[model samples]
Target chain A: MRALDVDYMLGLLPILLGYVPLTLFMAVVGMAFALVLAALMAVERVVRIPVLDIFVRLFISFFRGTPLLVQLFLFYFGLPQMLSFLTTINGVTATIMGLTLHFSAYMAESIRAAILGVDRAQWEASLAVGMTQAQMMRRIILPQAARVAAPTLVNYFIDMVKSTSLAFTLGVTELMGAAQKEAAGSFLYFEAFLVVATIYWIMVEALSFGQRRLETFLNKAHAR
Target chain B: MISVQNLNKSFGATPVLQDISLDIQPGERVVVIGPSGTGKSTLLRCLNFLDTPDSGKITIGDLSVDAAHASRADILGLRRRTGFVFQNYALFANKTARQNITEALVTVKGMSRADADARADTILRETGLEARADAYPASLSGGQQQRVGIGRAMALDAELLLFDEPTSALDPEWVGEVLDLMRKLAESRQTMLIVTHEMQFAREIADRILFMDDGRIAEEGPPADLLDTPRDPRTRAFLRRVG
Candidate 1:
């Protein structure tokens, strides 16, 4: 076995860092899309709208039941084969679509629970004031629900960042893909993989710090 | 004036409110007293269509709704004519005291922000919550939060006010302050319907007392008649237990 090359690993660090933005971009954009979609799904689940509720339940079950990797393949490979219109979707787009849809299913349940977790009294109070359903939701319910859902959302974003590694399978040269290419050329898998792992660990640590800060801010009024 | 007729509500097989009917002249203060689960709260909630009775007709001023056929617009109009104070206060936990009072003014009544702010300030002062106007409900004492709840309801200037166990959640020391504020409302002759366990406060403030038992109005009379003279054995038993 070749001795681990320290210089080769250090040289590969910048190349790996170069791809961090793409990975972060995918996670951030995917998170934004997923949050909005999840909120809509959550509202649908809560309201139990006639035909739409059935569709939302099936969608959530399917996405949450399947693995992200398989979903990515379905979006990137299978869908293109079945639908000619989807042929233009590249690996990055496919990965984002998969990430958004899959993670939205999970986030929707969290958001629904958070919304439901708001005191029933709050709903009564808003309605007692003559607020329409939309006004009550916009002015009262969703704000409190958003605070309850924020920490979980941050955790999901962190998970999404880590999951971006799977994008390399779709031929997208994100952080993991860049590290893999460098490791293959240098013939030093251990060193290259260790660098990528440390970077991911540091990123998650940063998010955990942010999560703590957010919780404190949200809890400030309730805090003694 | 407010009137409810044949108000019936049930949860599955359990009837919560049964054939409840009552009338309140303008500015009458009516207090409902009953054991927990007797549907006193359910009755007040149905007046505002909050509980959505299985079958009933509610009339407030010019607006009326039949529970079985109540359109959304009718429910909205009925609610707009009445104010409800929840048992737990239920001031928006995320909003400051002032915002909680002003939210409905701007959103429902179409008041300008400045006018709403002014009205909120005046109501906060009236409730002795001016000093705590900027505080969130979570940070306020239970009495203070209930005062905000009262203030929010009062600011609406609705034709009638409904309160559900307003002081039940307050500490003993805090209960006196809330009752004091409510006493002031009674003295001012606000048309109010209140559900509470505070028998003394109810007797002191109510123009009439309604003793609800087992989802029906078992007995009702003027405060002195109902509290001092007992006609129904159930009412006598309930009073003895709570007294």
Candidate 2:
């Protein structure tokens, strides 16, 4: 509104950069948790393990069908009131939990499709060779599924980094939080928000570049 | 020896294999020829417990499993004694030809890496896939991939090999190479149950050719008798069309 404060935007860039590590940490850690949980859910869905399959389906449907912000509040605000042990949950913990559960719901579908994408013959061949179900999954299915799911997972991770901005609503002073506080102090909301957006854009662009390189590397053997 | 008793399998209401029973003496090369959808592949799959039977008994070596009571351990044990080569060459896409051969050796057989690598090398040489050892399935031609599939199966040294239409997916040019390798295995007296459309190859290599129809063995005997002499009308009709 007040002439778009270019100088203020330039000055605030480094200050915001200071929070990049924490932002990256939340996204990375959230992704790690999400990857493991998603794989289990995907496998369960594929294997269709009696009652457990239905439970996993419901969890995935609920988390995936709902918004990340509501899930965060459910973890941070609603969960503690429902369970005494969850009283230990705080802003950062709540953010991580929300990110993990919410994103896992989406990632599970991707991983499941990837697992199914592997030729059916591979499973029969692995079984014929006397591989246990666990062995088949570890040595064959999961590895191939990882290759198929990698690009999509990387995209999710980039979205996750941007999604950490929502964590500011939970009282964690991550990058966006830092930006908000700076804007409040300097009364230059436009410039502060613009600086934060630019940083996020650069980070996403770098990840996109890495995604291409990784895809090329993964597909090199198949490339004629 | 392998013995199957009263093996029955169905998909929903449609019967794929009905009360099928047979025996294979050690080192007997049994080739099964039948029309598509007649359950020839299903029969081979059931022997290895790949397609769990609705009601049956399968015994390979000392391991035996019955359809009604087959446990996971029993299925695993039976599978350990047999190898399967899929029509599409089912070599692991992520692994190299050598690794595909070595995977079962190291993981299922619990062989040390050195031993597995040695076994893989021997099999690769046997299948004439040595030059393609490091190549992945997608990079190799169909013949080479199927050779890798056979090598992977042979590396396990399973008591029996079950081949489900091994050459069906190959191009015409590649089919002969695969048939030649299979001929070599037969010459070495590897016990095998093969389902194939290559009637000529079946006639040459089979100790007994089982002509299947409607999920049952319509006729079976010495390869020469089955191929040359008159038999069941169904068998005659099938041979007339394919031979």
Candidate 3:
């Protein structure tokens, strides 16, 4: 077996740095879409309207039951064959769409659980004060639910950042993609992959740190 | 200003309130007393449409609150006019005492934040919770939480206030503080309907006392007459047991 090439690996660091922004961009954009979609799905489940609730349940089940990688292929490769209009969808767009749908499903369930975790008497108390259902949700319920759901949502965001690496499989040149290309060209696979893994590990660690702070802040009211 | 006609409520096959009908005049203070599981709480909850009756009509002032005929908006409107205080206090655990009082004011009434805060501060002081205004519900004692609950209701400025076993959860020493607040509320002629096990508080503050059994009014009259000389044997037995 050949020894690892330290200099060559150190030299690839600058090249990999160029793809960092794109990786960050994908994660940020995916999170924005996921958060909005998750909030809507969470509210829908809470309201439990007749037919719409069934549709939301199916939506959540489908996205959460399957691997995100399969969903990405289905969206980027499979869907276009069925609907020609989606043929022009770029790798970046497809990756974001896949990430959003997958994460939103998980987020919806977490948020819904948080919303349900609130005391039932709060609902009665809110109604007793004359608040409409919409008013009760917007003013009383959501604010409280958001506090409980925030830490979990942040955890999902960290998972989302890691998941963005799958965009490399979709032919998007995110950090992992750049690392793979660099490793293949130089035949220093282990070194390039190690750098990529470190970057992801750092991102997740930073997010987890932030998550701890957020949980403490939100739970401040309950902490005697 | 409140009237109930043929009110009937049942949970599945079990009947809770049967043919319960009564009228309460404006500025009246009525205390409902009964054994546990006798539907005293259900009757009070039904009055505010919190627990919808299977059949009956409840008229508060001129507003009708029957689930069949009343629209959601109409029910909400009626609820706003009737403030309810619960046995457990039910203050939103996440909010401070001041925010708990001001939330409905700002959200439902659309008052400015400054205006809501001012009114909430006034009511907090009125309930003797001004010093704990910024405290969260978890930080407050059970009695203080109930005081905040009362302030939350009073902040709405409703025509009728409903108390469902308000002091039942408090320590015996703390119960006095809550009952004292109720005494002040009664003195101010605030029309109130209270369901309580505190016979002494009921005797001291209630203008009218109602003894309920199996969901029907067994007897009702001025507290003095009802407490000292209940006409119905059921009422007599209940009073004796509670005393």
Candidate 4:
């Protein structure tokens, strides 16, 4: 309503950008943990090993069915009530823990489906060549599965980066947190939020560009 | 180099391979021909324990495994001794034609990467795919893919090569190239057990042609005896239908 505060937003830009490292750090660490945990969960689902299969299925369903915000609250506020050790974890730890578990649920299903999508003939071919089960996975199945899973994995990573914005609610001073403070101080909510949104937009656009190049390179051999 | 005695396999109550007994000497080429679902493919798959036979004794070179009680080592030995070519080319889509050839040489045989690479070069040239050595299966034609599949099997140099309907999945135009490659391999006497529907090709390369029917080898003999004058009425009926 008041004439757009260009000077105010310009002053706020560096402050918002200053928190970029924390935001990226959360995203990077969360992704690494989620990818590994998702892979393990996917393996259990594929092999369906006894009692663990049921637990993994339920875990995936619970995380996927719940909102990321609610899951974050549960990790930060709810879980610590029951488990004493969780009380020592700061807001950043809780946010990372929440992001890892929440995104990994979705990732695990996609990963499992990708693994299953590989042609059965590949398994036979590997075995016929005297590959141990582990070799068949390492040399043949997983590599193919990883290619199939790539685009989806990249999509989730981008989404996870955006979801890092939610960490502001948990009291972590990420980009969104810095903007929230800047908006509170300047009373220029529109301009403050606008810059943060644009920064996120630029960030995602860069990721999308990278994803396109990766997909093209991966598709080269399969392209007819 | 491989012998199977009383090898039986069943899919839950329905028997797929029933009382199959056979012997293949080194350098022999045995071709099995029969109608679909009659266990011709199953016989080849069971030989490598891919289908996991119900009851049998399999002896390959000096290593032997019992169907019902094979240990991990026994099954691995069985797989190591025999190479299988699938109805589908089944080349690793992620691997190039050359890597397809080298994968087993390095993984199963424990050759160094350099040695495996060298072996891959030889196989690629032998299969006439030297020009396409770096090509992946997805980019290759059905014929080229099968050539890589054969090359992959060849690189292993197993005592026995088992082909389970190798050309059955190929396009009509692609079948001839694969058959030609197989004929070439046969000439080199690689000791093969091939299950094929290509009767004419069977007659040409077969030292022994097995006529399988109702989950059993109903009749078998040299190609001339089986093709010209089949002893069993079922064999005659089958050949008449296919011919």
Candidate 5:
């Protein structure tokens, strides 16, 4: 029987902690990029502009239909070969690109649903009040949609944090990759994984708590 | 003033309004009443080009708002001059009552934030929602939400206000408050075209009454003559059923 060693787990703690900032950077940057792109996609879909809507629909379908892992490979491996400029792209950039593309597809749908959930009469009401389409979108539609999309966007961000584990495949050496390397070197797989899992659990729990608070605040504002 | 000539509208093969003609003088208060499927709402919607008429001419002041003749910019201009209050209130769910009223003033009217805030505060207070100005639509009663809706339209200082069943969604007890607000608005001599089921309010307040049936105006006249002695049998039957 293999004895459990508290010392081995303690030794791995700093190593995992060292990679925490990288994980957070990846998640935050990826989410910001995804949300901006998602907002554009949502607006395009809602207006149903000529020819552009079809292109957006195809783009959303392609990204959402494929698995994230395969998409990562396609962007990191396939794109570099197809476009020489992309060949110089670094591992972190490639991982972020993949994360943004995959998550924005899902985020776009969430935002689109939120926009559509606003009553049809609101559009008429805005027009009746003399607002141009652009003004209405900026002042009325987007603010309301943000409230509807807030919780869902937070969920995607949490998923994005967990999905950062996949960044190891692109050679970014985030927390998960660091844990994998530590396990390989020390030959204590259980100890390394257990420590990494605890870090992830704590981070996710903190984000979820923050999300709940935001949701409650938004709900109160809505009730007002 | 608004005028319509040979207005036509349809949904695919199902015609909702056909060859309708009407004219509304400045400061006129016209009430349109009809059964569920009649084109009363469609007619009101077309006045501001909310729904484009298939073939027709709608002129408000100097602006011509025919779908075939007008540019998108012209349509938007016409819409700005004509305020519309929907049956559902249509308050932006995320905004407070004051924000909802001020949004257009700031965004479209190019009013300063401070000025808009002051105007919205005054309007909200006048609507009897001063205490609930910061409240959201979900928190307010149906009557309150409708009042906010009226305040929103009024904030635009539009030339004409269109009401499409403003009190239809309110609870029975709450309906009177909204009707009372409408009556007060009428007293201000605002130009209005209202589609309503409240016969008493229409009888007491409308300068002219239009009774629509099956995509056409079955009858129209002053409220006194129309409600008491409608020219069309269809109008008489409708008033009988609703009243």
Candidate 6:
């Protein structure tokens, strides 16, 4: 009914911007842990060791099959009731744990596919030269796999930045939390939501620009 | 010297290399010529434990391993003594031409990076790939890539070189360049075993020629004798088809 409030949107911008660091911090830390976990999961999938392999498959399925929101609640609320140590974890820690586990399940498959996509000849050639399996993987296989997985991995990171918005539901005041409080008090839902959405748009676009640069850099050797 | 005795391999029930045996003296260049799928390539691959022979014994230089009971160390030792040149020039896609040669030198041989680079430079110069030392495999022409493959092998200074149709994957025009490099290696008296369809190159380079058929060595002799005279009907038929 009322025209969009420019003054309120401008005032809300700085307050919301203050929480951007928390959002970014959670995403970056979550992504770093997720990448390491995903790599281990991917290798386990590829090697298919007996018991551990089955466990990894189930872990991926459970995390990937469930909704991220429910997973966050389980970490923050459900696990605390059963596990005494988990009860000490704050809302922020719970959100990060949830993000890491959820994204790892998705990214593990991408990393595994990239690892498998490398030509079999590369494996043969590395072994033919007397390289130990570890040496070959460190020097040869993983670098090529990283190149193949780069674009997909970046998309996950971008999705992760947006995913951090869900952190507010866990009682941590990230960007979305700040936007919610400002809209509630001022009763300017439309203006506050638009500004918050715009902030996310800008953040994602910046990531996309970085992704394009990364893709070009990674693809330099492959270009004929 | 390199020797393989009682080499046996199979893909499921179909035998790929059946009781295959051969010996090459130091500085000997033995070329394997045969029809496709007859296991000429399989024989060369078995020497390095690539393709994992169902059973066999291979002795190269100071290392000896029996396929049936080979340990990880034994396979690694056997692979160290033999260099393999693949048909498709499987140079590392991530490394430069120079790094491709230097990788094993640093990792397997435990040489310093500085020392490996020096050796890689010499190998690149020998294979005429010094100009493209920084080029990735995707950017190089097939012939140039194969040349780098040869250079990588040459850098190892292994007791024997195994070539599995090194030029077969190249374009017709590019084939000559790879063959020419092999000729140069032969002239230097490198102990080499090559499997190829190029009869003329085989004749020019082999100290002894081996003709494989039905996963067995049907006949073997000096280049002129095997290529010119008929020892076995299968060998003759194979030569007639490919030659």
List the candidates' TM-scores in order: 0.92, 0.95, 0.96, 0.94, 0.93, 0.96
- By DockQ, the better pick of 2 and 3 is 3
Q: Which stretches of candidate 5 lie over 4 Å from their true place?
A: none
* DockQ head-to-head 3 vs 4, winner: 3
lDDT of 2 by residue, A101-146 (tens): 9999999999999999988888988999999988999999998888
**What is the CA-based DockQ of model 3?**
0.77
lDDT of 2 by residue, B49-114 (tens): 888889999889998888879998998998999989999888888899899999988898899999
lDDT of 4 by residue, B1-243 (tens): 688999999999999988999999999999998888999988888888888989999999999888899998998998998888888888888888888898889888999999999998988887888899998888899999999999888888899999989998889999998999999999999999999999999999999999999999999999999999999999999999998
TM-score of chain B of 4: 0.98
Backbone clash pairs for candidate 5 read A224-B135, A224-B136
Question: Each candidate's chain B TM-score?
Answer: 0.98, 0.98, 0.97, 0.98, 0.97, 0.98
Q: Supply DockQ values for each candidate.
A: 0.60, 0.72, 0.77, 0.70, 0.64, 0.79
Q: What lDDT, from 0 to 1, does candidate 6 have?
A: 0.91
What lDDT does model 2 reach? 0.91
Model 1: CAPRI class: medium
Share of native interface contacts present in candidate 1:
0.77
Give per-candidate clash totals. 0, 0, 0, 0, 2, 0
Please give the ranking of all candidate structures by TM-score, highest first, separated by commas.
Answer: 6, 3, 2, 4, 5, 1
Residue-level lDDT of model 6, residues B1-89, one tens digit each, is 78889999999999999998888999999988888889988888888888889998888888888899989999899889889999999
Q: RMSDs, each prediction?
A: 2.4, 1.9, 1.7, 2.0, 2.2, 1.6
Candidate achieving the largest DockQ = 6
List candidate 3 segments past 4 Å from native.
none
Query: How much lDDT does each candidate structure score?
Result: 0.90, 0.91, 0.89, 0.90, 0.89, 0.91
- The true-versus-predicted C-alpha distance at residue A77 of model 6, in Å, is 1.6
